[model samples]
Every structure is written in C-alpha cells, then in structure tokens.
Target: MVDIRSPCILVCSIDVKSGFCFGCGRTRAEIASWLSLTSQERDTIMAELPRRLETVERRPRRETRRARIARQRREGQ
Candidate 1:
C-alpha cells in the first residue's frame, strides 16, 4: 500500500473543547485541507500531533483499524 502521511486512527469524531480529533488530534480545517497540503505541511502537522493529543481529555473507546491490524499480525506470528 502507498504510504499516507496522516494521523488518522480510523476514528473521526471531533472533540469540541480541544478542537482536535480524538484519534488524530487534527482540527476539522486541517483534516479538510489535508489532501491539498504539501507533504512537508503534512509532516509538520504530524510532528506536532503527539503533543497536541496530550491535551485531549479522552480517547476512542474502540480499537482502531491500525491497532487491529497490528494485533492480527502479532497473533498470526
């Protein structure tokens, strides 16, 4: 699969207070403009995501697609 420079965790809900997605910590505007942004711009946002997510009060209650795939791979081993 081609690499996608996105922070999405397959959970798309937005946190009103933080103005960031619970999964990717991206704002609605950022996510909306993601496809139009250059790779460098995406990378910069991705780099800042970790710290931005720290402010999110809660996380998704379900396993993400990435986590599920990872789990499946580990189990197959």
Candidate 2:
C-alpha cells in the first residue's frame, strides 16, 4: 500500500476561528483521517481543497502587544 503524502506544508498551526489548518488546507477530521487513506484518495481531497478553502470563513485572531510581551518574557529570551 502506498502511503498517501501529506498536504501539510510544515504549517501545523490551525486558525482558531476557522478550525482549519493553515498549512495543509485540511479540517481537523481530514487531518485525523490522513493515515487511513490511500494516495489516490488523498489526491482527490487535495484537488478539492482550494475551492473549500475559498469558501471557509476565518475568525480574526486577537493578540495584544502586551500579551505578546508577556509571553516573550516568560520564554526567557
């Protein structure tokens, strides 16, 4: 069985609002099912991803500068 190549482009981060991965263009369910699919099946999903992404509405991320500073301080860098 040929392993289906992941569409993940090393961008593991998901948009908190959209519940979609910014890197691979996959939903949480799809990502979870990746290993279970054949390469051909994966290809079909990949082909449809662009259109799906276009239709998804993403929530805006709210990050304050103060919060960023606090996080940086905690990281000790």
Candidate 3:
C-alpha cells in the first residue's frame, strides 16, 4: 500500500462558512473515508488542498505544540 500522508496538523476545527477543516482542508465525509480511499484518490484530494486553502476565509492552522509554546514565550516577553 502506498503511503499518502495526511495534511492534518492536529487543529481539527471546521470552519462553519467553508464547511472544511481548518487544518486538513477536508470535509467531514472526506476525512471519515480517508483511510479507505485509494492512493490516487488521496493524491487527487491532496492536489486540491492548496487551491482550497487559498480561497478559504481562514487559512489552515499548522501550529505545532512546540511552536505554540515558543510563540507564547515570545508574546509574554
């Protein structure tokens, strides 16, 4: 089986207006069936994410735990 990586950044919030996840740029249905999909299907969805993100009112939240900590430290200082 091919490894088609997920775009999830652990921020699972869905944007109400766009109906897509702010992190992975997928709808609930797409995320639900991701593991069952063929590699080609995954690739197709992956290809569209960039364009989808561009149009989305809010961009994906890719903040890692460490980044968040660092950001907080910077802001606190």
Candidate achieving higher TM-score, 2 or 3: 3
Candidate 3's C-alpha runs over 4 A off are 59-77
User: Highest TM-score: which candidate?
Assistant: 1
My TM-score estimates for the predictions, one after another, are 0.70, 0.56, 0.68
Question: Global lDDT of each model?
Answer: 0.83, 0.70, 0.77
| Candidate 3 local distance difference test against the native | 0.77
Ordered from best to worst TM-score, the candidate numbers read: 1, 3, 2
Task: For residues 1-77, write the lDDT of model 1, one tens digit per residue.
Answer: 55667787777767777898888999999999998898899999999999989988686556656667789999995
Lowest lDDT sum, 10 consecutive residues, model 3, at 58-67
Off by over 4 Å in 2: 1-3, 55-77
Could you tell me the TM-score of candidate 1? 0.70
List pairs with backbone clashes in candidate 1: none
Q: Candidate 1 vs candidate 2: which has greater lDDT?
A: 1
